[model samples]
Structure formats: C-alpha cells, structure tokens
Target: MSKLVFQSVAVNTDPMTQPTPTPALSAPDLTEIQTGRLADPFSLLGPSHRGHAGHLVVHLPDAQRVTAVIDGTAYPLAAQAPGVFAGMIPPGSAYILRVGNGSPENGAQEWEQEDPYRFGPVLGELDEYLIGEGTHQRLWHVLGARVIRHEGVEGTCFALWAPSAQAVAVVGDFNQWDARRAPMRPRGTTGVWELFIPGVAEGASYKYRIIGPDGRELPLKADPIGFGSEHPPQTASVVRSITGYGWRDAAWLEGRAEAQDRRAPMSVYEVHLGSWRKRGDRPLSYVEAATELVDYAVDMGFTHIELMPISEHPFAGSWGYQPVGLYAPTVRHGPPHEFRDLVDAAHARGLGIILDWVPGHFPSDAHGLAQFDGTALYEHADPREGFHPDWNTCIYNFGRREVVNYLTSNALYWLEEYHIDGLRVDAVASMLYRDYSRKAGEWVPNIHGGRENLEAIALLQRVNTLTYGAVPGSMMIAEESTSFPGVSRPVDAGGLGFGFKWNMGWMNDTLRYMEHAPIHRRHHHHLMTFGIDYAFSENFILPISHDEVVHGKGAMIAKMPGDAWEKFANLRAYYGYMWGHPGKKLLFMGCEFAQAHEWNHDAELDWAALSRPENAGIQRLVRDLNTLYRGTPALHARDCEAEGFAWLDGGATDISVFAWARFGGPGDDPVVVIANMTPVERPGWRCAFPQAGHWDEVLNTDAAIYGGGNRGNMGGVVTEAVAHHGHAQSAQITLPPLSTVMFRYRGAE
Candidate 1:
C-alpha cells in the first residue's frame, strides 16, 4: 500500500476502498446556519478545517450556484442545504465567493464579492476591554459604521454591541438585506459583533439583524451610534463621513474661550428652526437659516441664538425632545455638514449658537434603543427605575457606565464636532429626581432612601466637567426647575456643574404679576421685587422661552391684562424691566414682537405682526433693550453679583412703582431703573440717584416711537442734592404710565 495526497483534497492512494471523511459542518450546524440563529456562526461558516484540506462555507439563500474562487482556479461548492454551500479547497490566505449563473436548479445573474468573514475583527483588544468596562469615552468612533481600508481594500466596517444576542449580522443593500450572508464574528467576551465588508462606500444604508438569546429573530435595529440617518419615516442609518468640514470660525472660537465670561452680557434668542420661518410651509434648510437667522439675530443685537433641539428624532411633535439618534443631527433641516454650516455662519456674524440638548429620556419606539439586544442594555430593566411617567418614555440608566459614556460623548459631540457654543440641557429636573412625576410607591428611591437620583447626578457632574474641560468656551446650562443647590457651580465643589440655570421662578412670578390688572398689581408688587432676594444664589438666565408661550398658555402679549395700547405699553415696560434685571436674558422668537397667537410648532412665526406699529414698537424696544444691556457696564457687568443691585424704592407697593440702582466696578457709571406699573402717570416722581449730576434718560419704554404716550422726563433731569430713598442725591421726573425708564448719570450739570 502507498500513501498519496491530492492538491486541493487530501486522500490515501490505497486501491482498497475506504469511505471518505464526513463534511466539517454537521447536519445540526447546517440547520442553525439556514435558520439564521447560529450563536457561533464563525465556527461552522467561513474558512474551517476538514481532515487535511481547508473548507469554505457560505450561506446565500438567493444564490443558485456558488463557487470558491481562489487565485485563478474556481472550485464548485455543493449545496449541502438550501442557501448553504460548502466545499473543500487548498489552504489559502484569501478567496472570493462567486454566486448565481451555472447551476441547473436555478438560473440567476452572476455576482462575485469578497467574503465578509474572511476579514478579521475591526476592533482591537483595547477597544474590547474599554467597551466591556463601559468607559469608552469615544464609543462613537468605534461602534458605528465607519469607512475604512482593510487588507488594502476600502469598505465600511460595521460594529454593534449586542452582548445578549445569540447572533448578529450586517444586512444592507450590498448583501441584498440577507442576514445570513454577512454574519458577524463575535469578539471575545465583549458581546460586540463586527464585520468589515470590502467595497461598501459612504451613503450606503445599513442596519443590524439580531437574533435574540431566546433564539427568536428580532426586528432590525438602527445603529445606536449612527453618524447619520435617513429622514423621518425612514429608519435606516446611512453611512456618512463625519470629517472634511472646513470651518471658518477660528477667530470666534479663539476669542470665545476668553470672552464668554460670566460677567459678560449674554442675550439669547431662542428659536425653533422648523417653525421660525418656512418657505411656503416647508422648513428652511440649514444654509437658509444660517443666512437668515444669523443676520436677523445680529441685527436685533442678540448675542446668541439658542436653537430648539436639533438631534435626530422620529416624531415631529416631540420637537426633538424624544431623540432616538443622539449622535446624529436630524435630517429635517439638511445633512450634518449643513448643520455645521449653520453654526459656522452664526459665529461669522458674531453670534454664539446654543443647542437645546435632551438627554433625560428617550422614546420607546420599536426601532429605537428600547429593549436593545432583547435586554435593558441602555435603560433600567424595572419600570420604576427606567420609565418616565411624565414623558411616557424610557429613562437612561445613568448608573450604567456605558450609558453615561454615551451621553457624555453626545454632549461633546455637538460642541467639538459642530462647534456649538453651548448646550441648554432640557428637562434636567426630571433627571435629578427619581420620583419626578410618580406617585408614592410608584417610584424607586436611591440607596439612601431619598428622592435624589445619585447616578443621574454623577452623570451630570461628569458630563459637565468633561464638556467644559474638553471644549473651551462651551457653556452647559440647566433647565432644571427644582431648587437643586449649586447647579451652576464647579463639579469638584460638589455642585451639578452647570454654567447657568434658567430662572423659571422669576419668569413665572413676573408673568403672573403682569397678568393682574394695573390697579390690582399694587397688591402683588412683591412678585416683581422678590426674585432679587435670591438673584445671586445661582448664575441665571431670564428666559421667556417657547414653553411659556405654547400649550394654551397664550402669547406673552396676551398675558398682559389691558386694552390694546395699554397692553403694548405694559409689554414694552416688561421688556425694559427684564433687560435691566440682574441676569442674562433669553427671548423666544415671536416674543420680541409680541406675537398675537401662541407658538405653534406646525406654523411659522407671525412676521406680519410687525406691520402694526404697536408690534413694531415692541420689536424696536427689544432691540434697543439688547443694545443698552450689551453696552452698559452697570446693567450687565455684575448681573450675578449681589453688591451690584440696591433697592431705591421697592416699598412703594401702594403706588405701583418700583425703583432700583445698578452699580458697576469703581469709576464705572451707575444706572437707575424705575417702573410705574399703574396706568397713572406721575408728573414729579422723585427717586434716589447714585450721584448729584446730570442724569441722561438713556432709555424710556414710554417713548413715542415705541408706541407710548411720550410721557417721560425731557431728555434728562439734573439730580438734586436732596435726601430721598436713602440716597444723598435725587431726581424728580415724570413717570410714564404703565412703563419702565432707565437713566445714566452723565456729569455734573
């Protein structure tokens, strides 16, 4: 007997018959591969050992015939089962799979491509270790579909974290959406599935088809870290390049690091880009908004434009609050690069752009992160810990390190990737409390049995710290309504580490007080003066945001309890008062012109309202107020300092009149602000002045041009060396009816 070997198949050259060895893949493995539930598809499929020869296995249900093409030789693969093809071949480093055409069973078009499983894992050992530990700060750089060149072949690499899944596969147009064709290889212990398919290019739509650990097939899921997604109603994630954007705001960025000081004047114009101004009911593109919104904000003297949430959201009604794709900017406006253009355009016009970020809860859409991997991987498993009653959404499990990293990276993504100047974190109060909107026994308490959500607190602190440290000049503002202490303090100082907090209390109080009839306002005068008691407690932004004008609350102008002319006067007076108040300012889009109707997300603002003089006057008043607030040191220099403000006549409730003085640094000019909330004009109202000098009436809400009766001091009044309101100097001037006035001392007359 002589031993012999074949080139592609090893065999003994004995003349006596000996049965050939069985195939490498058994019947059970073939069944698993055909059903697409094989936990270890890599073990049976792809290249494997068969006796002394190498075997190639491929599962293509649509293919009529398949051949393993190694070098120039084509080896036919026998159909072991429907969609399951296998054959023995010579050992080789590379091979391609050719399918269709040449089979007698079914005649189909022929297509040849590199086998996806032939490539090794895209992520390295460090990536696996960090991801498993949930501390991969730049998870977006790894998990999402990234275009890379592997083995000198350029293609997109798809990776997903589905630890509990029995199997995962990359299904896209390239593979004709066949799950079995591109089965991914599971990395060791990371629960991450990755496959690098050569020749897949940018703009290719893709998703993961995961088989649950229970052996049940699941709905295909969109990529959690998708860089871009199709427009709403289309859930597939699109492969997009995150780089190659040319920024022209270097000067703005450099100056912003030093110029965005707490003491500096910041007047933000909050806008919903979708409803701001649509072209015949269609929303403006990012480029259009860049030119229109940027120029308008600049002309109006606003320092920043706080855009309502722009993250990728499924429902338009949620207004980006129930965002599904945290890493992707919504495609409603335009592509990601166009959004970047909007930010760059804003900076070019010397205006900062602030994004309203929502990280509190996510919608439980079927295609979203809910029940991802058939497990509570991103959220809490218990409803008491994960569900948000108020929002009817799922709260992120901030206690999970991976969830925290996901959110923290999202914050930095907007700031560093898009050059966003700041983020107005939305619904932070809900995130801060475990029993936010739940009744007794309906919520779970922290380890200390308190209402505080310690994990969410820690997450906020870490995100804030990371944001401010990583992105210079980036601001993190909290829309937290509760009295959570030190919200705007540094993280190391045991605070939530926000740059500013929205003054919801002040907004509510002032709005309520303004709603009362002028005569009745005298009794509630405390509402006007009470905010100052704790004005310096936290850095604040006085926001007349969209929330106040929507949901049947009526517009800001409608909140005024007066006739047409009186209403205009009252609103102008309020505008002046707010600009003169001790805090940064934010005004919603239509509030500047006193929009008649409440804000509707479906419609554009009432730009026609400005055609009326009263509305135009309000707009002009707001613009002037912004100018005055930005230019005057006394008004904004120490807006967050207690020593900057003093009450000159806050006790005059019976007369519906209040007066105050704002002081600046030594030698800087001082300003006097007085408001007569009543409809009665006082001819000779005396208020304490900072010095004995000529006090120039810099801004009068009752000026005729501002749709007022022109009842004010003539140009200015000379301060008299008379004791009044606890000051050595006093000025007696005409107080406009239902109006606010501001004066600055010029020099000794």
Candidate 2:
C-alpha cells in the first residue's frame, strides 16, 4: 500500500479553505514535527487537501487511537511517526481531532478538541507593517497572548517579537508542556511569530520556547507584555484578560487635572503596601487595601495615596523597583482587576492614586526580558551601557525603537487601564546621565561625547508625551535629584516633560540641618534657607520618602539629635517646617506617626508606637498640618511660585530661629510662620507681620494637644504699633523652645 503525504500548504487564514493536489509529507518533515523543531507546523499538521481527499495530521503522543470526526462520520488516522498521525478524508471537510488514551491501571479516557493549526494567522497587514517599522503605538494590541475569536473558533492568539529566534512555539500544561505540540507561523519580514490556538483561553499558564539564532534552545521566556504573572517562586505568564474592567472613576478622572494642579494643595501619603499593614505574616491584599488604606489616607487628610510600586516583581526586597511584569500588578496583593478596585476605591473617596513607576532599569531574571531571543533584546549588548552597577540590574536599551515603543505604551496602559492619576518615575537621575554612579571610563559617552544619555532622555520625553497625550489629566513626575534644567517643563520647551520633580535637595538639606544638635545648628542655618534659592526652579514636591528611613538611616524620630522629650518636639517642629514650606508634600508611611525604628520591608509599620502620647502627638501634628495646609490658601495657592513667599528673617542664625510669610493672590489672607529652634524660651521676642491686625494662632507645635509646652500667644494677639524687619506691624511673641507657630492674619483692629 502506497502511504500518501502532501506538500506544505500556505493557507492565509484556514488551510481547509484551499483544496489542491500536493506531494506527500517527507520523512524529514515527520522527524522535525516529532522533535518540535519544525519551521512551520501549519504545513505539516492540521487539515489540508489533495483533490477530493482531505488530509489531516495531529501529534497525539501516547494515543492508542486518533480519529477525525467530520459531520458525524468517523475517519481513523494512522500513525506516520511516533505519536505523529496522518490520514486522508473528504477534501474541505471541517473536522475535530479525537484522541484516546487507554491503560491497564486506568480506564479508557478520550478527549475531542478542535485542531489549533487549522486556524489562520490573526495578525493583519497593518499590524505587520506597524510592527516592522517599530512604530506600533499600541504594540500590546498585537503582541502577547490575547483571547479572541479566530476563524469562528474562540481561542487565544499568541504573538511574539523574537526576530533573532530560529523557531518559536507556545507551550503550556494543556499540551503537557511540550513545545512540539504548537509551533507558530512567522509573518514575512515583520519578525513576529503568531499562532491562533483553539481551546487556549484565559487562565491558561503559558511561556515561549524559542530556538535562538544560534540554534540553541534558550530558557523558557515569559511574555514581555503579559498582563498577569504567577505569584513568584514559580514564574509563568498567566493568560489573564485585561479588558472589561468597568471603571467607576469616570467622575474623578474628569476632574483630575484640577485636583493635581500645581497650585492646588497636594498632600501625598506615600506607602509601601507590603509593609504598611499586615493580616498576619502576609501583607494586605489589594482588595483589602481598597477599604483600609484608602480610608486611612482620606482620614489623614491626604489628597493622594502614592504606592511605592504594585508592579509584579520577582523579589519582594526590590519593592517592585525591578519589575519583570510591568503590566501585571503584583499577585502578592491581588490580581490585575483587584488593583483596579484599589484605584477606584481611592477615587471614590476623593483621593488620587500615584504609582511609583520604574523605567530606568529592570532586573535580569531568567524568565524576564533578559536574553529574550538569546540576545540583549531589551537591554544594551555592551555591559558599559547595558548594566547598572549600583543596583546590579540591566539598563534599558532606549535607543532601540521597539524598546521605546514597549516602554512608552506601558506607561499609557497603566494610566488608561488602571485609572492611575499619576506616575512618579523613579531613579530618573540614573537615566539622565551615562556616567551616573560609574567611574569615568566604565561608561559610554553619547554621540556628543558627553556623559548624558541622549537615548534615555528621548525615551523619557516620549513616554511623558505619549502618556499625557493619551490619558487626560495624567501627571508624569520625576524622581530626579540632579540640577537638570527644565525637568518639569514640557518636552517641546526643551525639557523632560515631567509634571513635577521631587525636591531631593530640600529633603537632604533640611534633614541634615535638623540632624545637627541645637547648639551647633547655627553653623548649618544656611542649609535651612538654601532651598528657597531654587524652590521655584521646577514644580517641586517636598518628599520625605521611604529612602530616608531605611538601611541604617534610622526612623524620623531617631534622626533628631536630642533626648526623648526634645526628639518628639524636634520631629513635630520639622513637620511644621515642611508643611509651611512652599511645595507639594509627600510623607513616607510610619514617618507621620514617628515610628520608633527603621522601616523593614519584611514587617508591617510599628502601628503600636502610636499608643505613646508623644508618638500620638506626632500623628496629631501631621493631621493638623495637612488640615491647615489644605484649608489655608495662603499656605498653598502659590506653593510653586516665588511671589507666594517672603523671608521676614532668614539671618536669625545665632538664635537658630527663622520666620517666613506665605501669601495667596490679591486680597487673600497672609499667614506667618515662626520657628524657635532652641530650647530656651525667648519671651517678648518681636516678629514682623505683613499687616497690623489681630493674628490668630492657627497651629502651634508646642500646644498641649501636641505634647508641647502650651506657650503660645494666648490664642490671638494684636500687633503693637512698632516697625520691625521691613514689616508695618510687629508682634511681641513668646518663642517656645523647639517649637513652630503658624499665625493667620485677621482683619485690621
């Protein structure tokens, strides 16, 4: 008997549509298909035709019987090779493959399923063209696993951009984790491999098995654009659909611009979700945080809740800074939809949510983007430009157009998909310069022979431009520490186009000044006033972030150089100074309540510390500070403008005291802030006022409620008819030891 085989047929969509006379399958083809090394499984497998005969092939490993059922008639398929079955049937007959596995130990078990290879390519010409040009603004649309109906069959369409790979296949537990079961078709010249697999739907765990350009099989790689990942320690890309999340934040989204306006008061409470609170030994899930964390932020008078990073990461220690799945919110908390719930929960409570986005570098995990196609596909090939020595991670190859497309779209995805109010890009300083934290010769200079990373700068600008342009009212902030010019300016205006920049200089100088003992504080007086010199250079956020209170830095209370009583007072005073300063504010978790110890990512915050009167006082002071900062327009309206501030006395270095005035627009009330840095009470000390009138003490760090000495100006004081420090009105006030007092001017007496 002559065994009939056919030549590989090219079916644009479905192989069953075309009936043509063809030669038989070669021995080499059978061998290739058996070993999972076949270039095009579509040609060797699935249903094809030769005149009136429809030939079908399926690799049903260990199957005792393989049958093709066409409109109720059964046609048995014979084995051409080990588990490789092929036979003839009526040409153009639509059929499903049925395989039977019978064993002595177990009863006969049979399953019937549609052949995946019978379906055609899901990608169209437009997708191929845009992908080939590396200009796919919606790159995620065509790449990665997407559940869709293809050729009238509901299944998942798998696509990947591995131009350098010799072969690629989709592998999952459904196929017994065998790559040989499903090889993908390469679209011409686009460098994209695609396959539409019937019965492979959402919730399936999958990864790509690639034969690299060197013909060596690389480690299984997780989907670069996967929307979900297996909880770490067992890495696999889960087929979780990111669509159909009906957002309840439309109202909030509409008014986000006004809420995030630079002039608007923005008091952010930054938190690391894993360590913020815990149920037992585990962190609160995103669903639980939706209630607890959101309510807490609102109760604390915060306008926004800034999460450190919810992006899926391999190591919890990295705190999501080294995210492997940027699209997937970490399963450590909850799934993607639950994270969306967290965002919506915040908006429902009138609190905006900001994500600490990390685009500067990615960790080199085996299943991650590292050596994706047996090449440095997502990072630079040269270690000098590719590797981050400081963090021991991989710096992105921003020069590649595809890489740029990937990152830029990722930013937009978070904003559009999750309803995130803003993204505070982390470690931006590292991306701005090529020589960051590197010895001179260890880094590569840009084309201009400068230390600046021009490519990275362009990528940052594009991401900002794209995200803002796509998602209305989306803020792009930079965690930039350098003196880079125009960091918060628009890209067209020769800047990185960030909405705001973290005032790292202010944080450093102020913390250093506060760390010094009171007697020696006179020498560091300039540090306290130095920030005003460039306060308005960029729209700034005065961030006392988590970085300050970790890794031997000690808690905020520990940083104060004094005895227990003075420590609480110093912290309360510093909080006052921070609130009175001219900038948006961000306080790390635990810092608000004066956590007695350094932050540990492994444990929840020292919530028990608030039981102490002094600790509770710090918490009370923060709540009052936020209340005052928000309620008083004079303190915040011109926060980013120079005209809003006036130094009444910056040269009171000998007394370690400072006084400043904050103003709003014309006819608005003016607020005066006076700080007494020393422990000695200076009674009858006169301070300047903008107008001669009765001034009400709005907030005093030394008030009894805040565990203070109760030495303020008896609720309200009338200015005396005396000139002082370039002001028309002067007030004889008692300066409480290590205290800060805020006074709002009332109408003229």
Q: Estimate, for each residue in 1-749, the C-alpha lDDT of model 1 and write its tens digit.
A: 00112124223334353223337568787888887766666677776633233677878787668777665556677788887888766655486776775455555467677776566677989999998887777787788888888887778888888889988888887777878777787889988888787888878888889888787778888898888888889988888778789999999999996556788899999999999999997899999999999999999999999999988889999978998888888888988899999999999888999999988889999888998898988999999989998889999999988788788988988888899999999999999999998899999989999999999999999999999998888899999897889999898888999999999999999999999999898889989999999899999999999999988999999999889988888999899889888999999999999999999999999999899999999999999999998999899889899988999999999998889999888887999999889899999888889788998999999998999999888889998899997789897889989899999979888
lDDT of 2 by residue, 74-175 (tens): 667777777888776666667777677777578986667777766768898998998888778787788888888877777788898888888899898667
Lowest summed lDDT over 10 consecutive residues: which window, candidate 2? 1-10
Query: Best candidate per TM-score, number?
Result: 2
Query: Can you give the lDDT of residue 341 in candidate 1?
Result: 91
lDDT by candidate, in order shown: 0.86, 0.87
